[model samples]
Target: MTRRTRRTRPSPTALPGRTVPVAGSIAAQSPHHCRTSPFSSRLSYDSESMRCRKGRTPRTLILPLAPTGPMIRRMPPLLTIHFLPTTVESARLAGTVAVMIDVLRASTTVTHALAAGCDSIRPCRDVVEARQLAARPPACPDNLGPLLAGERGGTRIDGFDLGNSPSHFTTTAVGGRTIIFTTTNGTSALEHCRPADMVLVAAFCNIRAVADTLVQRNQPVHLVCAGTDGEITAEDCLCAGAIGLELQDHGGFDTHSHDATRIAISRYQQLAHDSDQLLAELRDSHGGRNLQKLGFDDDIAFACRHDTIDLVPAFDTHSSTIRTLS
Candidate 1:
C-alpha cells in the first residue's frame, strides 16, 4: 500500500493538465469544491524521486517518489465500471481489484452487519446454496449458527432469517453472528468477479472508506455495479461515480477511461447537493421503485448516507467470506 505524508506551502499555479491528489486525509469538500484558502493545497504523490521537495509551493505539494520502484509508465487505471453482469465471466476485470456495488440494500446491509459486529459474512451464490451453508456452517472460533439472509425480486425469500434490508441487520439480531448472505444483485456480482485479483463489497454507507482503501492500495481497479436485474441502476452508477471522484482526488488520473469515469462523475456532481432531489431520483429509479414497492423506504434513506459506517469489507479469497479491515 502507498503511504502519504502531508506538507504545506504557499499555493502555486498548477501546471496545465495536471490534477493533484488531496493528500493524507480525504479533502472535506465537494467533488466540485473550490478553494480560496492559500494553504488549502495538499501534497501529490510523485512517482519519480524519493523525497518531498521544498521548492515552489504549488496548489498541491508534489512529493518526490522512490527513484526506482515498480514503475509502470502506462496510463493509470481508469475508474471503470461494468453496469451489470449477465454472465460471471468478465474479461476486462480479469485481474483487477473489483468492488461490487449494490447501494439500495445488499451492500448497505452487509456493511451494516459488519459494523454492527457480525464476525464475518459468507456470501453464497444462490438462495439454495445459502441455505445449505446456513445448515452446515464451516468450523470457526465461534460455533454459532450463521444467520440466513437474502432476497428475491426485491422481496424476502421464505425461511430466511433476514431479508436484504439494512434495518434488519442491527446489532441485537446480527452481532457476533456469521452471516450466510445471498442477495439478488450484490452476491451475483461477487461471484462474477471471482476472476478479480481482489473483491470488495461497497455502498454509499461506506463509500469513503472504500475509496480510501483503494487509494492506499495504489492499484488499478474495476468497479462492478450489481445492477437491478440485468440493467443499469442509477443508484449504483451514482455510487460508482462517487468512487471515481474520490479516486481522482488521490492522483488516480493519467490512467483511466474518460468515457466511463466522465459520465459517472457528471451524474454524481449534478445531484450531489439537494438531498431531497437525490432521494427523489433514487426513489424513481428502477431498483429504488422495486425496493419502495416492497416497503423498504427506510432502507432507501439508510443507503443514501455517505461515510456513516467506517468499515471496508473485503472478500477473503481463501475463506470465501467478507471480512472487515480495521
Candidate 2:
C-alpha cells in the first residue's frame, strides 16, 4: 500500500524540542532557545550554538521566527471513569458521551430487553415511580402498555410483572412491550447522567459493541459505574476497564484519563488473561455476592461473559427511553 503525504506549515509557537516535518526529512526544533536553517535537514542544534553534523557548506534558509508569547494549549480528549455516580460532577458531563455500567444485572438486562424486541425501556428511580410510569397512558399512539420490572434487596418487588434478570427479558415475555424499570443503582445512575450529550448502557455482554461505538463517536467519554448500594463494586469497574482496554486499541488513554480509570484498568488486567478467573472475580464481587445469596448465579454468569451481545443501547434523556443506537 502506498502512503499518501500531506504538507503542513510549521507553527512558530510549536512546543519546544518537538519534531516537525522540514524539507524532505524530520527535524527537531526548539521554539525558544535554538534556531536552525530551514533548507538543510542535516543541521543539529544545542543550547549554545547550531552546527552542521557533516562537512557541508553553511547556507542561509529563511524560516519564520519563533513567537515569544504565552502559548495556549488545547485540552486533550479524556476517557474518565467514575467509580460511583456521586463521584462525577454533572457539569463535566455536558459534552461527554457517558457509559453507564451495572454489569451484574441492570445494564445486561436492558441490553437483552432491546435485543429481545422490547419496544423501549423507561428507567425510573424507584419502585413507586416505575409503577406510576407503567400506569400512565402511552405517550405515542402506537406505543404498547409498559410493563413493570425492577428489584429491591436483590429480589423482585411484589406486584411487578418482571424482575431485573437478563433471562426475564426474553422475547416471549418483553417482546412488543415497553418496560418501566427501576433499580437500586442502575436507573438512578442513568438519571444522574442526564446532562451528558449522550448516555450509553454497557455491560460485559455488549462491551465490544460499546467500545466500538465510543471509538466511532471519538468524543470525550465518562464511564460511570452504578455501584452497589452507594459503595463501589468490582464488577462494574471491571466492565468499565474492559471497555477502556478495547478503546486503547483505537485512541488509547491520554493524560486526562482519570485515576479511577487507572484502577479499573489494573483490576481488569488481573483477570484479562483467563475467562474462568474473570467469571470467578465477578462471582466474588460485592454485587456478585449479593446476587449469589439470592441464587441468581445464572444471571451473574450471563453478565460475566464478554462480547456475547452485539447491540449497543443508548439512553435518551428527552424521551426517557433506552433504545438501540442507530
Candidate 3:
C-alpha cells in the first residue's frame, strides 16, 4: 500500500504499553474478523494472546465529539474512535453503544461460540469467578456443562474446559452450553463496558454484522480496542479503524476525527485492500508471534477471515450473558 499520511509517534502517555470494552443492535445479523502499525508493518498487531506479556504502560486518547476545528462540518458525528487505556475506569465509555474489539481470540471466540449455538456467554474476570459461574450452567434442557474457558500466558488455565482459541469453540463442544469466559485482555474489556447502554463484541469474522447494526442504530459509537496485556496493541487499533471506516461509509459518521481515531483510520486505509497480507504481516506483532509459538497460527488465520458468520453477541448488563443481538 502506498503511504499517504505521515505516521505520528505515540504520545508520552501512549508509549508502548500492554492491554484491552462494548452493544445493542438493529436486530440484524451477519458474519465476520485485529492489529498492526500505524506506519511500520513491523510493529503491527496480529494476535490476541499478549495478556501475560510484561512491562508496558497503559494509555488512552479520545477524539472528543465537540467540534474544535473548521475542518469539521456541522456537528461532529456521534462516533468517537477512542484509543483507550486497558482499564475499567475510563469515563469516556458512557454511551448507548460500545463495540468491543479483541480480534486475536476473545471476541472472536465469543462470536464463534455463540454462532455455534452456545446458549450464552458470561465473561468473567478471573478463573475463580468463571469456575463459580460454571457450577451453575444456566439449567439447560440438554444438561450440557457450562464451559470454563480462558488462558493465562497463552496456555489454557488448569481445570478449565477450554482455552481462548476460536477453534476450540466448535459446535459439538460449545453448542447448547453456556461459556464463562475469562481472558487476559478481552474479558476485562467486556467488564469495562458494563456501564454502557449497549455492548457488542466485534472481530474480523463478524465485522459486517456489527457494522450493519451500527449503521442502523443512530446512537453514539464507541470503538473499544481491547489492547494486549493492558498495553496498546496494533491489531486492536486496526480493528477499531476498520470499524470506524465502515461506520463512516455506511452509517454516515462524519470524517472529522482526532489523534488515535485518525491513526486508526489511516492504518485501516493502508491495510483494507489486502486483509490476508495484513493479517499475515501483523502476525509478526508480539501477540501474533507469541501465539504462533503456542501453535495457534491456524487460529490467527481463522480469526482473520472477514464475514464468515452472522451473529452479533451483545452483552446484556442485566443478564450477564452475551447472546446474538437479535
RMSD of each: 11.0, 18.8, 12.7
What are the lDDT scores of the predictions, listed in order? 0.67, 0.72, 0.66
User: What C-alpha lDDT, on a 0 to 100 scale, does residue 314 get in candidate 3?
Assistant: 95
Residue-level lDDT tens digits of model 2 in 1-326: 12112111112222111211222111112222112222123223322211112222322223334477665443435889999999988777999899999987999899878766677888988887777777784663346567889999988899998898886676668777788888889999998899999999998767767876786676789999999999999999988888877665444335235788878877776676655667788889999999999998777766765544457789999888998786
Candidate no. 1 TM-score: 0.76
Per-candidate TM-scores read 0.76, 0.75, 0.74
Estimate the TM-score for candidate 3: 0.74
The list of candidate 2 runs beyond 4 A from truth reads: 1-76, 139-144, 252-256
Q: Write the per-residue lDDT of candidate 3 for residues 44-125, one digit (tens) a residue.
A: 2222321111122221222345456444333435666656545335456676688888888798889878766778888888
Candidate 3 stretches with Cα past 4 Å from truth are: 1-76, 87-89
Which candidate do you rate higher for lDDT, 1 or 2? 2
Residue range with the least summed lDDT across 10 consecutive positions in model 3: 18-27
Instruction: State which candidate has the highest TM-score.
Output: 1
Write the number of the candidate with greater TM-score, choosing between 2 and 3. Answer: 2
Candidate 1 clash pair list: 12-58, 49-65, 50-65, 75-255, 76-254, 76-255, 77-255, 78-256
Clash number for every model? Answer: 8, 0, 36
Write the residue-wise lDDT of candidate 1 on 1-326 in tens digits.
13222221101222100122212111212221112111113222222321112222222323446578864454555566666765235766766788998898788888878766688899987888888887788765567678888888877889988888786776577778888888877887887777777888898766657877786565677878888888889999888877777676556443255576678777776776545556677788888999888887766766766554456788877788998864
